[model samples]
Target chain A: MRLENVWLRYHRRGPWVLQGIDVRIGPGEVAIVLGRNGVGKSTLLQVAAGVLRPGRGRVTDRPARVGWVPERFPADQPFTVTRYLTGMARVAGLGRAAADEAVTSWTDRLGLAAFRSVRLPELSKGTAQKVGLAQALLRPPGLLVLDEPWEGLDAATRELVPELIAEVLAVDGSVLVSDHRGETVRLPAARRWLVADGSLSEETSSTDETIAVVEVAVPAARVAGTVARLRAEGHQVLRVRSDASTAVSQALPVEPPRSAGAARPAEPPLGMAGELTAEQPEAADDAVESAAGETR
Target chain B: MSALVRMRLAGFLRTGRALAPLLAGLITLGTLYGGGRAQPAEAYGVSAVVLFPVLAWQTKILLDVEPDVQRRLAQVTVGVARERSAGLLAAAVAALVTVAVALLFPWLVGGVSGPVDPGDRSIPVGLALGLWAHLLVVPAAVALGALASRASVGGAGYGVAVLALGGVGAVVFGLTGSVAPWLAPPIMAAARTTAGDAAALTLLGLSGWALAWSAAVVGGYLWRRRAQG
Candidate 1:
């Protein structure tokens, strides 16, 4: 599916959330919509989900199935986890008997069986997020839209997220997401789209990062595993620093975003306005040199 | 409709929240008309009985939201808007019915074999009808709270709203004319006035109003759901 010349906005004086954004996800391709907070990662995802109509452009090549897991799981009822997922499955058009079977399968795969009998409000944040994610995957979809799904999960559960995505893709579904810690993902072919200043552009290792720079290195063989482990632990493991063999100092393994109600980071970036990346932003030689030099 | 019925039933069992208070109000009203029965030596159960709706709505609205990605993604989910609206209305109506039944129970039971002559039960009828009218208004108020939740409106806001709604109902009943007198029927549904003139008129009017408002609120919810992306 491709979004072409699309723009969206809220009430008057409300900033333009997305402008002149264009990108495409080919058959069987996954694209991670990337940006700091407030960049309309959700709005864009909604538009794709057909929940919101775009103000300016068209999102084309849609399949009949669009799956979504918003940041918050919409399980406000006192229904047990199993009941709720089955209810959602029914809503998605699955028959009762089939929906029940699907719910059981998803809860097992998502490791929510322990919580199967618990009501939504009583579940922990991570458990709740699992429910939210399970809502979309109960049945295969043509496209899956996940908004910051890794936010409140634990390390073990976080590792399962990418695998879940792979499973979705395996069944011929494509995924679109907006996450920052990208290294741990096994979807080696993911395209990156950076959103800034309400504009969307495909980043190809060239997007600029004006923030402070820091570099640390580990063995190459351990790089992917190390990064995945760190991210699963919930650190904002930025661009991989693959240049040296700086021995491990006192290390804080990446932590999965804290439990569901975990305190949100103080200030997210500006809304998606500047540009989007359909691939990794190119770290120019000079810029990498400067980022490497900035630390010294 | 089954979903709506299920939600409404859940609303009934959520006794510790809004149902408790609504039940308390009914109990008091029933006592007034019951020739005085149905009260506990302690007031704790009464408090629990009467304040259920307010508690349920306040808790769900204030804390149920995903505080983390609230602004960006809390409401986005699967299914169409009508599904949510129907579910909400079903839930709210079911809850309201349970509360009405509890409040009106004393008079209902008393009518079967008590000192109050069956025909003179208008007072209990009025109070019950009055409270049901109030319950009918609650879902809209709670939904308003739910909608405004994204804006971070506090419990104080809901408190003010519920108190104001209740107060207004009381004041209207105090006035020469009933404030809305809109819910006279469901309140008066089991009244001894089952065969009266004024009693039937008020009941019809109140029923029409509650039904209309419920339909309208559910319509609004559906619209919002459809509008979301």
Candidate 2:
């Protein structure tokens, strides 16, 4: 999908929320829209989602199926969770049987199974956001646009979001998302489009600092906690392999310091393993298994 | 579109927004036909005239039931045109329900009295003309509702004002339509035609005027939405 020199204003004499914005995202691509508050990030996402038509230019080659999830799902309605999703599925062109199946599947997948019969207006913010996600994914859309999707989500669901984005991309769908919480770090490879002054500019991803990979060994029970800490600290965990040599053996490769001035003395548990040249997958299956095992 | 219509109707019913206009319509019908018997066509003509505002109000209520965000979601799910048409269709369905109740209310009150053209007894002329008048008014009323919809004009207060004014215009100008019939919906003409011995050409003309008014209002509404977008 492509927006060609699009311009938009809410009212006839209103200031332009978006001006001369030209952006394109292809199949299998994800674009993360970044901007400060009230900078039209939501407006840009809305335009890309086809919710708002640009006053000046046109959005061309928009996919037939576009899944749009707003920042806040308006759940103050009369329908229950299941009923609402089913209705949305049918609106998205699913047949009755298919709509039901999709609703059931999505509700369960989003951890909303227990709330299937619960009314929307009674749901908490987090649960409502999950519902919003489920409705959008009822049918795998060719273009998925989410505005502040991470807001009001629990930790587990927050992690599931990147997985959902990956699923859409796996189907060769394009995704446009706006983020404020920096949770988008999970999508390290997503293209970043910064919105400022009612215009969008793409940011290049290039860093030239020297790199180092530090390997750390922690107890099996602490493995999950340690990995979480490392990731939170801006260090990338490369791999997690169980060791039969001891109770458990884990290898964590940490990224170089964010800045040269922040270099510090090495810690005991963390030792500098040789710098790894290649980037590892963000969510390795073994890492997930280790985390789940720790939880269990 | 069907999904949207169904959702809107469900919302309309569940929200209880359908009650005020419905109760108002029933009460008005009861008061109009209470303990009084008249020619079916004439009574129904007056009934149709009063029901015009009621139907328009109901349509507006139905159209405005869905919140803006949900409506946007529907628009994204099924394009703008389909979503919009769904809202209008839902409103039309609500208007039809009111029409059905009005049609039956008089009979429930034992208000019909009269024969057809002195030779025909197969179909009651009052009933036929009542149905015809209602059919004639539905499009125009729905259009007025659409014009006064929250989508067309922002804010609840403003929408109500627009609808009330439009309803009054349709009634007043319809009654005095001889001065400038094209300025308002042909509702009064419909009632007059139903109550009197009207020619087939005249009936066709009323239908044309109603349809033309509906087209203009709906067209302007769709254009406004597109422009606002």
Candidate 3:
């Protein structure tokens, strides 16, 4: 998909939210969009998703089936979770049986099996976000655009988000996701696109700073603190294991602290093995199994 | 496009909001039926007074059931033209029901009284013309409602406009003894039905006027939407 020199404003006299922005993402590539608040990140995503038309220039080669999950899903509708997902699945071009099966599968995968019959308006924020995610994935979109997909999600579900992205990528689909919390480190590899001042630019990371996936094992009681400490020390803790065992392992980068002041000591902390493992970007399955084994 | 139309139609039908049109239609039918032994003019006046505004208001309520966000989302799936067509089709359904009830009420309640011209095979012809004429009100009122919505007019505002327009049309037709002045479908139908001479020409003229008015209103509405977009 490609947007070539797109310019957009809400109204004829309104100021432009996006100006001369050109970007493209090929099939199976994930593009992580970064920007501060009110910097047209959502607008860019909407234009790319075909929800909004640009005033000048054009978007070409967008897939017929594009899935878009807005920052806040409009969950005040009268339908139940299952009904809504089924309707959306049909709208996205699924057959009756396919739509039903997709709805059931996505609801279960997103941990919304219990809320399938529950009305949308009655759901909590996290549950509603899960429903939003499920709807976006129900039809296996050719291009997936998500705005703040991680916001309001529970820890375990947040961990599952990367797997969802990987699933889409495995099907040769393109994904464009916007995140403010930098949680996209969980993605295997992503091209960073930064939006500022109504313009977009691709940011290139230096080759010297490589991201490594580390497996951490800690007691269940210290899981939250361990993840927080890893994050505080400038290590991007991707996911924490969610099994019924005393030991918990997290996959995180082995990069040093971003800031000199936040740097940790040369030695790894107690009960936390910060071994410098090689870059195993496609080792998500092995990581899950290792985390589960440590818990046993 | 069919899916969107079905969705809108289903949404309109499955809600309590659908009752507004039904109630308005019932009231119009009742008023027309109560005008027993009266001339067709009385029936037409009653229809104008009660049916037009209420039907317009009911259509507004039905259309409002799909929130703006949902509408926008649907528009993304089906283009804007399809979305607007679906909404208009739904409105037309409500209008058709109301008009059918109004036109058929007289036959249902018992044939019209006090008017038996042996040469006047024009009653059925008049009835057909009237049906065609009155059906035009649906598209007109829906177009007016769409324009009102675009202008951000509240429901009460559009309702009042519809009622006032109908009332003024009736009053003007009464004073002029000509349906052409107001372009009011009900009044034109009534005038044609009561007119003993050249009823066919009058019916044709009335149909032409009603259709022209409907086309103009709906055309203007489409123009405004395109302009805004």
Candidate 4:
């Protein structure tokens, strides 16, 4: 899929959010979009997903089955989780039996078994996000565009996201994801597309060995297990601190983490951590828990 | 196309928005059946006029309840033409049900038996004309509702507008006797009972007018959607 010189604004008189932007993603390639809030990341993704039309230029080679998960799923709908998923599956051209099976499998896989019968409005943010993910993955979309896929997910499901992306990639489906958190580290060899000032710049990963700094925080009790898991995932645990302050300082090889040894890490200990330099201070606690609480 | 229509019908039924029109139709049917014993043509004319408000309100509800995201999805899948047709079909079905139930009321109450005007035709013929008139008006009302909604008119506004238009048409028909048949659908339908030689011509003219009006409304709606996009 390709966006050629696309320009967009919310209204005719509104300032342009995207100006003369051109980007492309080939089949089976995953592109991780990086940008701060309100930098047209969602708009770009929406344009790519065919949800929004650009004012100028055009998108070409868009696949027939394009699955897009917006930043905030509209959960004000009247259908229950299973019913909604089944309806979406049917819309995606699945037969009744197949739609039912897909709904059941996705609900179970996303740990949404208990809430299958619950109405969407009654679901928590995290559970609703899971439902959003399930609906997007219900059909094997040729192009999958996701905005903030991991924002409200639980730790286990957050870890499961990479596997979902991998599954789409394995089937040669292109994936585009926007993230505020540094969760793109979990993706298997993704091209980085940085969105700044309405224009996108592609950044290819360096082949030479380099060092990556990551912060991890866990309860002092599970420090040993967390360290072991980090090392098993091929990150060198440069330092480990044991305090009510949950801070993890590490220096790792820049190569993509080995998927074979990337087991679910141990659950984190209670108490909040100081903000990591790369992450927002307000979101530090949630980020620490997300990064640490990945035990299967 | 059938699946799309079925989906629309199912959604309308599940949401229970069809009940408002059904209730109004029942009331109108009861009133018309009670009054038609004396003058069948007038009863059918009044009933046809009553359809304006009932169908306009119902169509507005249908348009409001249609999910925007689902419509876009359908555009990518089954195409927009089929989606639009399905929506129109669903609204037409609701209008048909309402008018059909009203038409059955006269039969249920032991038929239209009374002293008929010298110029008036048979009860069966009047009822048939009423049915045909409804067949035309229902879709026209649905299309008008679509256009009104695109103009940001609420259901109440649409209802009032239809009532006012019908009232003005009735006044013009009353003032200009010979032109009544061409000016208003209810007048044209009511005239069907009394005019023996020109009945076929009147039916052909009303059908043509209805078709033209419906086409214009649907065309306007499509143009608006394209322009907005």
The top-ranked prediction according to DockQ is: 2
TM-score of chain B of 2: 0.94
Per-residue lDDT over A102-167 for candidate 1, one digit per residue giving the tens place of the 0 to 100 score: 998888988898999998878888889999888778778788898778867766667787888887
Checking candidate 2 for backbone clashes, the offending pairs are none
State TM-scores per candidate: 0.61, 0.83, 0.72, 0.74
Alpha carbon lDDT of each predicted model: 0.54, 0.80, 0.67, 0.68
Of candidate 4 chain A, the 10-residue stretch with the lowest lDDT total is A272-281
Give me the candidate number with maximum lDDT: 2
Q: What is the lDDT of residue B49 in candidate 4?
A: 65
- lDDT of prediction 1: 0.54
Best-first order by DockQ? 2, 3, 4, 1
The candidates' DockQ values read 0.14, 0.60, 0.23, 0.20
Return the lDDT, model 2, position A109. Answer: 85
Residue range A99-212, candidate 2, lDDT tens digits: 999998988888999999999999999999999999899999999998989888766687789999999999999999998655576677799999999999999875732223
Compared with the true structure, what per-residue lDDT tens digits does model 3 show for residues B72-126?
5665555567767877787777777777777767766763544466754345555
Question: If you assessed candidate 4 against the hidden native complex, which CAPRI class would it receive?
Answer: incorrect
Better of 1 and 3 by lDDT: 3
Q: Look at candidate 4 and give me any clashing residue pairs.
A: A216-A248, A219-A269
Q: Candidate 4, residues A1-296: lDDT per residue as tens digits?
A: 99999998876798988999998899989999887789999889888887667899899999888877777776756678988788777767789999999999999999999999998889999998888888888888888888899887766787788888889889989999998765666774888899989899998765532233334555666667666665465444544445433233221232234333332225553532221222122233333453422201
